[model samples]
Target: MIKRIYPQIQGEIESGEDVLEEYSRDWSIFKINPSAVAFPKNSSDICTLVNWASLENKNGHRVSLTGRSAGTDMTGGPLNESLIVSFSRYTNKIISIGDKEATVQPGCYFRDFDKATLRKNLIYPAYPASRDLCALGGIVNNNSAGEKTLKYGKADKWVKSLRVVLSDGNEYEFRGFSGKDLEAVMARGDLFGRVHREIFRICTENKELLEKAKPKTTKNSAGYALWDVWDGRTLNLSKLIIGAQGTLGLVTEATLGLIIPPKHSRLAVIFMSDMKEIAKVVDICMKFKPESLESYDDSTLKVAMRYAPEMLSVIGAKNIVKLAYDFMPEIWRVIRHGMPKIVLLCEVAGEDEEEIKSDLDRLKANLSGEGFEVRLAATEEEAKKYWAIRRHSFALLTRHAGERKTAPFIDDVAVPYENLYQYLPALEETLKPYRKFFVYTVAGHVGDGNFHIIPLANLSDPKVRALIPRICEEVYRLTVEHGGTITAEHNDGLIRTPFLNIQYLPEVINLFEEVKRLFDPLSIFNPGKKVHGDIAYAMSHIK
Candidate 1:
């Protein structure tokens, strides 16, 4: 049926050229064409096709599928070819809206949804940096978070219910206790007994780790829904599927919690010559528990400058203007007698302007006590202008890297805040031995103990390309030694699968596999992803 109807769908399926490119490839370093693509019209369409695929797979023939939205993922969340499925067309409805809950098609964009909710003076605030482009499905899949995560938390936090299509062609609504609404189901003796049995079995087996699982930050989207368990209240099954990466089931739709938007916001810039100062400032700023505490090192600042120079200027900074010459010339760029090596571009929002000002003063005093300079954005507009510079600088600085620079991929690793000073220098030492390459920036969400790195190196030489991973491997190993994870924001997709085992122990890694097999026994739904043993298989299927 798909083969017959698909030919005609090429035109109707994609009303605009945007679909072709938008649905094409994920951020992974692979690409391929799916056998068929879908822009589901509703839950019915998503369910029917998924049920068909599940049945086909159970009969010893598994059809591969990949679900994606907006193509904004850098961790290979989208694909060009396969039985690619999308939610772009089914975004027209808001299933139900109550005082604190909203059931929506998972494809809705945050900006659109937030604007509508604002009319009613309500908000759905699991925002990500890419919220402007990210979809609800993508947010849940990645367990995404943003600067505001300090308060609202991640995608998983907002989920109240999930509409899922299980692997065996079954669709079920497994979710949080709906007050008295679900009292009937909870009272169903046999079904309730079985559901609780499976959940208890999985939880019991994972109890040890669950105790130790303390999320890296208040937010994370690592593997599955391991963080869904909580006592004292009734069980909420939807939480388990909230961050499952499309493994156990395909989320056709979801019902989530919402909030009220903040009335006021303040943006500020704190400059430091060292990463340590940023950490110190974080400890103090965290006390205010303001909306966000964001930091970026010079490497990231370079990019943000191009993208958000107004941000840098707000703090009285111009481009460091990196020289293409050699190590000696590059040294001049940071010499203070060097440009500032690191800066924190932060946004704090609240209801009281006086409180915001007081918080800014406290922040400045702490930063100044360390003998650093501080820049504050007087209003939201000015703050955004500066942020624009910071955001764009990540890309802007590279354009003139003079064929000597390559787009730096972020190594989303994190260690305890106190350990970063030690960890960072050790990482630099390993790089120094490979003299030809340049180091990128080291900026992060210090308040949460997670940082992103752009290890910009000139990998044009074959020798340099081979050496790249070797250097990264050393850094990854060091991070593990410090009891940190190799990935913080991005999951270990095909790109990082080869190193996953080294980072995770045999037993821990094995459990990840067990979970995968249970969810996708045939291994056709996103094969060669998020597991250890499939490293070799993943290398073969790039896109």
Candidate 2:
């Protein structure tokens, strides 16, 4: 019975069946199976497995608890059935490093915390292009961002405090305070001062309806960032548990906050062949404020040149005739300008290397005086093959989709960059009747008018799993009519938590179910993520 009531849980508590089928799949397309996984080895073995799953849910039993790490959650938010608690074997660690901050341990590894913040040159710039296979508890529960988050932004703006564990199993810590240290943390009466006096009285009586329910895009990890916790001068419940995917609890340490990049960088690479000139080349690459714009299409460069030597282990390419002689100038620009339906990439940094090559020669002469073509990665190994095809084109369509898979349901949508010239052509005419049932890929972080599409399908074809909620209700109703954000960095797990009221409202999803009953009042964490998700139990747990 859970190792005789958590006999000081040192770790490993399996329930076999190949550890519940490897904790029942993650990079989402749900599979669920958990029923005992536990591997904690710290935070007092996660407060004795959340006090033995809150005393096996006060005896009635269907107990819960999810927390996982490096399961690279694409939004199954560390899938759960009951009790999973992984934290990368022995709570990974790094636990300290300063001069701007570090702290670590949510099963560490964002490529080992970006090689320990680049040996003190400092970083942790909101990593995520599955930064060499995620962790740091899925980049602080998926508040993750990528391609240098178009100038450092997500992972809850570089965290800076957490620790967590709640649902009364204890372990507090959080951060951010203000005037009179937020009234001595809401007059410490306990349970972390009634969860900081009822999340500071539900964010000061819904401060202007949570600042008009934020998310005008440019990054959001679906719901319960309770409008970034009381902004009228600091209250920060670690900004609502940094993207609450762990469902308001089980964090187990993290501090973050770091920077110090730019010593000079570069990379240009455009190549459009027109998709209505991607909002006029993202409005002239936002007047050269680039620090990563990124893109990918042409069906992810024809599935990374039909798995060109399995992308020689992600753009390091030492073989396959030096990766087909470095993609022979993109196979002679697809036999002289023919296949480029999109391939941006921008980048641009500085501390002055001749003003980063005169801002990439005036951003390739204002994208060739608007006639467009551009191409400037003169090295950094020609910018690692456009970041190895924008970070391995969704792991090369989940390993050569011969019998399809990678269906990240409308994967991370995001809008508002002046409504991508009328929302990317009404989202490619609302997925043109599901492109005859599958085949997709578009990629993202184009300076934050995010995208990610994915698709691939075949979910053992139950009519292509009944067109995943009618293509997530026509691409989240055209991404909330272009104001966008139905996840800009993968978070409303189990498939966009039953479509968060198609991008919130209804009094901000009833104050996100009263901030999940004021911090899990017995819902026992990570249950159908971000408030009661269902869509027929997430489409009968699609796989």
- TM-score on alpha carbons, each prediction: 0.82, 0.35
True lDDT of residue 499, candidate 2: 84
Report lDDT per candidate. Answer: 0.61, 0.83
Tens-place lDDT per residue, model 1, 1-543, is 445433222212442445555555664434555565677776566666666666667776647667776555655655534476777666446677778878877778876777777788888776666656667787776666666766677777788777777665556777656446445654564533345445555666776775565444444545554436544356665665665556566777778788776777777677677654555676767777767777767666545534343333433443322111112322454563466666676667777878878888887777678677777776555565545544444345445556555323335676665566677677667667766566566656666567666555554655655564576577778876766766666555555656766565566566667666666666656665566424445434433
RMSD to the true structure for each prediction, in A, is: 5.7, 21.0
Q: For model 1, where is the 10-residue window of minimal lDDT?
A: 320-329
Give the clash count for model 1: 30
Worst 10 residues of 2 by lDDT: 1-10
